[model samples]
Target: MGFWDWLTGRDTPPPAPVPEVDPAPTEGDILASLDGVDQLISGGALPAVVRSRAARVTRLVRQTLPRLGSLGLGSYDSYSVVATATDYLPEAIGAYLRLPRDWADSRPVENGKTPLLLLIDQLDLLGATMEKIYDAANSTDAAALITHGKFLQERFGHSPAADLNVPTPPSGNSPDPFDLERP
Candidate 1:
């Protein structure tokens, strides 16, 4: 090392880089963690409502997961969404399950929701995400797809102007699609 560099303390080597790791857990890992959460809640002295909520979380997770797998979420892109469900689902339920009964129900957090409410909301959001993922994955189902299409057709397929089969008046102004043409 040069004398000036050593004296100035400018020759220090950079620290070794930390290894990169996947942020999200696998579906199997999440399921396993959820089993732990289930056991904890089931064995706890928590109130019946808390126990029921935890049970519901487990039920939805179990129901959504296999369908997710069947929907071919094998790649990283598709599976990334599944990661949040696995991670947060257990954390929310487990947090409520682990907290003391009084604290979970009575103690208020900053957002006006008690710890229990927060947990329930998180679980609900997770359930909705799972449902959305399931719907997207199952889009290949022709009957269901057709059913949805038919519903949209009945509700919004025909505009007022189109329903009357009237030709739109020629105008210089921007045409309002909602403005029905007078026959």
Candidate 2:
């Protein structure tokens, strides 16, 4: 049975929860887990794995910036290097290196806003959002949010700005390939 099936009690009772295990995972462990997920997402090819993980790591840097403070500097550089190394996958690496610049140029800026804007755009990727959610949910505020409280409800429950509509992608002049394929 799959891991999810077992966890949801569809396959078998979860082996009795081991009493109070360590919650913190080492960096090596985290990277190993990421590597496995990268492989699954990109097949067994090393180049594909590197490209996929670099994209994921870039997203992670963006979403965690608020929490990272100054520690993100080295992490950002390492990710960039991984994205640029051509010995493994020259084309993929080149593509990854190009992303930050392209994303930067495309972002709107009024008065010399920092590159953080580009990072925020990167955070729009799902992996970054998921990381932020995970980090936030683990903080001390998690319990406060879970328990009923007026402050919590007022602060997080409603925001007019949150409802603002963003522009959508323009439709293409040509018919979609999928539409043409239909009988």
Candidate 3:
């Protein structure tokens, strides 16, 4: 039925039009490239190189936090604006830092550090995993992972250390997805 007809109660509203957005590439497609690389790392399903890169990136961002905070306006809101405008560097770093050691081996192997390297690597793997999940139809597991990544990407993507001008908690009354640890 046409919209005009439905509006006049002549017929029920036609089904809502499906969005035209293109589906993102699948996880299987990217996983095919990673192959057994994930298994080689401490996390047993994340890439080590990606972890190293994420740690290095986070370290650099952490160094800039002080300078960024000191910029003009010097308010939390200003910090958020500047941070979000930059790039996803901060988020990548935050995700690396927030990763549970248990998931990637709590003990550090090199430089007397815990296996943070492995954890960071897992974040990179997670980015790839997100790309796949975004492409596929909704699954409980996939939804959970995507929700986690989205929060990390949105919250820490700009400046993980910078305080946002929102309430005590970023999203008021919003349930936290990360609170549920993936086992």
Q: Which residues of candidate 3, in runs, are more than 4 Å off?
A: 1-44, 73-183
Among these predicted structures, which one has the highest TM-score? Answer: 1
Residue-level lDDT of model 2, residues 114-182, one tens digit each, is 343433333234344445443653453566556746675677896556678767557877556679666
Candidate 2: segments with Cα more than 4 A from true spot: 1-19, 44-54, 57-125, 128-183
Error of 1 at 21 (Å): 2.4
Backbone clash total for model 3 is: 9
Of the candidates numbered 1 and 2, which has the greater TM-score value?
Answer: 1
What lDDT tens digits, residue by residue, belong to model 3 across residues 90-143?
444445546664754566666655555644554555445333332332344467
lDDT of each: 0.67, 0.46, 0.46
- Higher-ranked by TM-score: 2 or 3: 2
Candidate order, TM-score descending = 1, 2, 3
Better of 1 and 2 by lDDT: 1
Give the range of the ten consecutive residues with the poorest summed lDDT in model 2. Answer: 81-90
What's the CA error at residue 18 for candidate 2, in Å? 12
